[model samples]
Target chain A: MSSLQLPILWAMLCLYVGAFVLDVYQFFQSNEKVKKAAVIVTVLAVAVNGILVVLRGILIQGLPLNNGFEFGMCFALAIGIIYLILLKKFALSQIGAFIMPISIALSCWLLNLDMSVNPLNPSLRSYWLSFHVTAAVIAYGTFAISFGLAIAYLLREQGKLQKMPEAEVLDEVSYKMVFVGMPFLTIMLITGAVWAEYAWGTFWSWDPKETFALVTWLVYAIYLHIRLMRGWRGKKTAILSIIGFVAVIFTFFGVSYLLPGLHSYIS
Target chain B: MHKFLRSLASLKLAIYLLAAMAGLYAVAAVYGDMEIYSSWMFRLLMAVFWLNLFSCTVLHLPGAWRISRRKAKADFAGSGYENIAQAENCSQDEITAVLKKMGFKMDTAENEQGICIFAQKGKASLFAPHVLHLAILIIIIGAFLVSFAVSGAVICTDGQKVALPSAVAAKIGEGYEIVVEKFETVYDDQGAVDNWVTTLDLTKDGEVVASGQSMVNHPLIYKDLTIYQNSYKYHFLLSLEGVNAEADGVYSLPEDLAVDVSDDLTLIAHGLSDEEVFVHVRYKGEEQTYTLILGEPFAFKDGISMEYGGENNYTILQIKYAQGSKVVFLGFIIACLASVMFWSSRYREIYLRQAKDGAWQGRVYCKSPEIMRKMKEDFETNLRGK
Candidate 1:
């Protein structure tokens, strides 16, 4: 919490790296024990990451969700938690092989970010800040899972059509995952707009962040419509869902850093 | 009526509504940045956008109709439900027929519990889309109404009595005038402003009613009217000195000071002194002829630069007017509450059925599983643990 607790942080970092290595090994080896070991490592790393967040929050008197560094760390933790739950529920042990590495990469990226604490502005003092930001993080985490599913879906579709190892199952799982993700993304959009209206004078200010969020929402909306109305199944649906998640990534990181807007907190 | 309402609440309508909103917002973004766009026109366009978006979200009848028609067609085709027998020793035609009879238009079975069916049911899920959109529209309308119907600003100097604008005055309801008892500004050591404070007295028919001091970001509210410190500027006093003699007559000592005699010769004064011979000058528009003292400087107008002994000097102090309203604040609160309700209160249901063989089969569905996962996990874990 005091920024000098490097030992604990370093240990977490080591575990994160180990988890990534184990996940990669499981992916290639296709061993059930290796896969289970990867899941356990991921769960442990996520728990440690959760403790880091809680300690930071305790020191700050609230969650460290005020800036990009904190957001990246929190997002990584959320994704780790989500991946573990999905792995346990669907017996999707292979996903951890990919998800843990992504989580580690994000955590490393967070470490590189500026860790300075910014004083909360008067407008951000409302209780809604927690609600708004927490929802956004959860929504982003869902999209990340959807992205992974889409990639798996595309790969599986290619493999199945080529008389490969029944990758069609991957496409189904991706579709189901996206179907799960869409609603949270919708709620995230609605909540963000509401928060904007309260803090600023207007509901929609046409800020770059707002615009990109709308674009992201549209991409997913198109994905849903294609899936529902056109009966788009298989690899094609997987590809579109993946494209939707890419748009979400652009909205979250690209818009915040590359585009100028009222959401200058990230900058 | 029930059928109509159900159609209106369909998911298809929600998608259309969201798409339309995105399109309109794109248009608004383009137009909002153009200086040539009139404010009134911009406001009108915004209002139309809000109305269309809100209507689409709130009205579910059209979606219900589309879904119902799709359902009727599926029924006619005799494809409506799960064709469970298709898995074992069934021809393609027989499989298709059984699927049709089971109310499934198209079906694919993966594994034991993974059955993907394309059939139209639970049209109520469509209502979720409308719910989000309608909430947004209501927030916009509420804000717009407050902006147009009930907000105003008033400017008053120290000891000045000003009538509040009609928009705010009428709402205050008879027998009240606002008086600025005093206005003061505090500045930091760096000469930057720290804050502006205005002492106000609300009077009723020449008698003092209520009085309080309001500062920047701190508003005073009375009878649903709120006032905030908006902004301020500077006012200055000026004097002049020194004189000189010109070819026509006596002129100012400052060579730059201009004097005109019969519009032929004009004398300009450069500098003036207070105890020296000063030039007496009169302009065509002057009501009282005054002498310009030597070695002294005076401001000619509200903001005019003057030089004295190779140095420029100016004096002015600014006074600010505060503006605010309770209606806009109320709208903000409502919008926040609406957002929380819309995002947090999600309605979802999962249908699970056990096959005759006692194998567990189910579909898990929700608006936002990411947000609901903690709850879902807790339930699953607790159930399993028990």
Candidate 2:
């Protein structure tokens, strides 16, 4: 890690925390100014996260997505970008109260992880891997946002999050996020299979990572079907969406740590 | 029978099966048992899931097709559009012109009530869900076909030529062999291995058929079969040379291999270094450690000696012939394209009717509120201008 990198990470971490605090203040007081400030802080944190990724990439002479820390930072950046887009397009600032904390947690997690860049594994040195991981970052990032929106929906359903967006809007936004994310997740799975066929001679090996990813996909698939085809909405779909994101989380982190498989190197 | 088909075609059943499958996948993943994927129960579940998806798709197909083909419904009030707008004093031609100006493909139908102008965008997106479903079924079929694929691995040293394993050859074909012309470990500037590259030739009937360098992430494809550079290993051999050289043997070393050297005196290859092979010698009730370097013999007793016999490198190549890979690839391509279409394309419709009072009532069907609002605003603006 470079000298400038650590300081920038620290600054970004602080910015994320600041953004979360601001969002929380806005939630309690219903202040538009605080909401705007939280979005601005989040934008800065995301920008810094991008800079960190670029700097790490330059230092390593490759994408910074090859390791947990770099990918976590990239994931945080994706979350921030998606959150801002939801806020801008859907006027969903209330969900930021749930989202910014996740960004902060990821930032803190990144800070604790090893910052040094290592040589890329021979198996991971492919253009397909870049596409696969990039798609995963986007898909997982949107799922994270949906997770937050689901929580907000549940809270508002219980009448606790009185100032938040209506349960219907939250449900719709969560569904929309999944709608946008499923394709990226599909891309991730396809690109991964293509890469595996080249490197491992088998497209689907039932590796724990692959299985967990498929499970996550299945969960979201269920969410989409129930909500779209059956017209099921509100707390049921919200809970299902939350479960889907939990599956995503497990697929991302738990699989790497607990299960030994083709993707064990990721841990 | 109809009820059974309906049950199979039920969306609720699809959701339940998906949820169950997700649970099974999670269990299989957490249990770290890949055998679960190939188990009979799992296969049965997959078959049922596929059947359900097929039934659902079949049941929904006619409705989807009709929706895709049907022109604008004449009943604007009963059109079931969520966003409704009113435009004053607009002629049927004016509404058509405004809708056309707003980038809608116009289709007009006249009825007893009035003229109904049906404007639509992203019509192809109406079939996006079916595309996704069909793509997944194709993928599942491909996966099923791949279950019978033939695969095997062979290790080859530099300059060694080896035929495909009988198990793989019997399926792919016979008379095919791979010649490892060269094998080298390429290292980056940091001295870490960047790749294990094997330059090889695929030969059939003693004639060269294909030649390429197969490295990690870069497999050599030959017709239906592909060869991958899976892994590499080095064997440190321990050689004994002398009068008692009858105990000489080639053993994979750095792994504790105990050899009975004349019963009482035993030799165990214990470790390895660049210059020497470490061994434990138990002789005459005493254990002694010795480092036997290349070209330097260690005399144990009565002319018995041991030396490092050097290291041999071999590259492990995995050869696979998946029959349904092309089908699977096609499914993947269709799936990715359909996903893009499903997410990026937003189908919108305008059901418009000019009332006898010269006022127009219209309904907009769009999932996105912002887009629907914009379309309605644009329609009203365009109508007022007209």
Candidate 3:
């Protein structure tokens, strides 16, 4: 490992923590300057996180998506980017108080995991690795943002986060995030299936990872139906959004640690 | 009967089935996959979900078509259309040009209210949900067909023609066989296995019909069938001397090669290493272990000896043929396109009505408040020139 790698990672983690703190403080003070500063700090953290991933990829002579730490770093960067996009497009900076913590937690997790890059195994060397894992990163990141929006909705319903966007707007934006994320999630599932067929001799083997991914997709599928078809809104849709993100979390971490399968090597 | 059909076709039932399926999958993830996914109960649930989805799609088809065909009404009564701008005199030519520039399909009609201009875009997205649901139904049918897909594996040396399983052979024809042309393991600079490559030929009637290389991520595909490099195995031949009734023979790894020279004596090739083989000599209830080097005989206490002949490396090739993969791929394409259309595309309608006293009023209709605001901004900016 390079001498500067560990300190760089720690510095990125501290910057994320700083952004998270600024977001929290902005929630109380309702200062536009604090919100802007928080976003800048988040951008800086994400940039550093992205640089670390690229450095690792260069050192390993491959994409840094082979293990938990690499994926976590990518996931954190993706979440930061998605959060910034949501803020820019929807003027949803108020939910950063809820969104920034997820990136912080992921960055902290990355710090603890083994950052050593290993040579790609025979099965891991495939072009599908980029498409499948990239889609997963974006899908999970969007769902994480939706989770934060749903939390803001619930808190607003309880007469908290008074400065945040309206509960109705939060619900709507949360639905929009799902609307955006589901396509990427579908792509992830389809590409994973195609890759598995080439690598494992089956399209759908019902491995724990595949099963949990389906579960996560189905959870979001249900959320979309209730919101779009049944006219569900506010607390009900928010709760469903939260449940879907929980499923995403389980698919990402729980299946790897608790359930050993063909993808156990990823853990 | 009508109520039952309506219930089957209802969104409520679809939501219930989806939630139930999610819960079932969660359980499967926790417990195990094969026991649940291959169960009749799971199949039955999938069948029910399929039926619900099919019925829902069929029932909603006409509605989606109607939505695609319908136009915005000129009347503003009880409509959630907020008036964006008012003008004393608005130019219809400029309005049409602006709406056209904004990508709205233009239509105009004269009603009792006024000269009404209705412009809408992304009307095709109205059917996007139907297409997505239909795509999912197609995928479900494909998955059902894939349950009958057959696969098998066989180990073969170079130029060996291995017969496929009867089930697969029946589908692909019995005259066809897999011939392993060459097999080699590629190593990276770190001395780790980079890949296992197996060049294969599909032969029919003793003539080569197809040829390709199969590796970990690159399977040789022909028609609907594929050949994958699954693994490798080692088989060793042993030369025996100073023993009776057993000569040189071939044996595979993971299983000992045992030769009973006599009732009271037996010789075994226990294991293999880079340049030596572990030979077990069992004589009258007492056993001895000795390393038998290649082409060299090692003698034991009773003058029993064994020699290592050599090893034959075999590549394990997996043959798989999925019947409905094409259908699944088709469904996948449709699903991807439909999902993008359903989510990213926005259906916007601009309603412009001329009020009394030569003034014009306009309202933008959309599901998204952000898009609606943007449309309103565009309208105000464009018509502000008037």
lDDT of candidate 2 at residue B153, scale 0 to 100: 94
lDDT by residue (tens digit), candidate 1, B1-386: 55564465455655655555555554544344533223675566556556555454445546645553442111112222222221333333443454344333443333353323233333444454455455456555655654444545666556778776666666666676778777766554445555666788878788877678766535455554555555443221123222222332222233344545434323343323323332334434553223344345545432322222221211111121212223434444444444344333334333323233433332334444453454345434433333
Q: What's the lDDT for residue A60 in model 2?
A: 87
**Interface RMSD, every prediction, one decimal place:** 6.3, 1.1, 1.3
TM-score of model number 3: 0.87
Off by over 4 Å in 3: A1-3, A28-33, B1-5, B69-90, B108-116, B235-311, B353-363
Pairs that collide in candidate 3 are none
**Per-residue C-alpha lDDT of model 2 across residues A1-267, encoded as one tens digit per residue:** 577788999999898888888877876788868777878888898898889889988998888778788779889989999988888888777677799888888888777777876788888889998899999999999999999999998888888968888888898888889988998999999999999988888888889889989998998888888887777888888888889888888887888888878888776
Better of 2 and 3 by TM-score: 3
Of the candidates shown, which would achieve the greatest TM-score relative to the real structure? 3
Docking class of 2: medium
Candidate 1 RMSD computed on C-alpha atoms after optimal superposition onto the true structure:
13.8
Tell me the lDDT of model 1 at A65.
Answer: 79
Candidate 1 chain A has its poorest 10 consecutive residues by lDDT at A159-168
Between candidates 1 and 2, name the one with more favorable lDDT: 2
Q: Is candidate 2 or candidate 3 better by lDDT?
A: 2
lDDT of each: 0.55, 0.82, 0.81
Position A119, candidate 3: lDDT = 71
Docking outcome class, model 1: incorrect
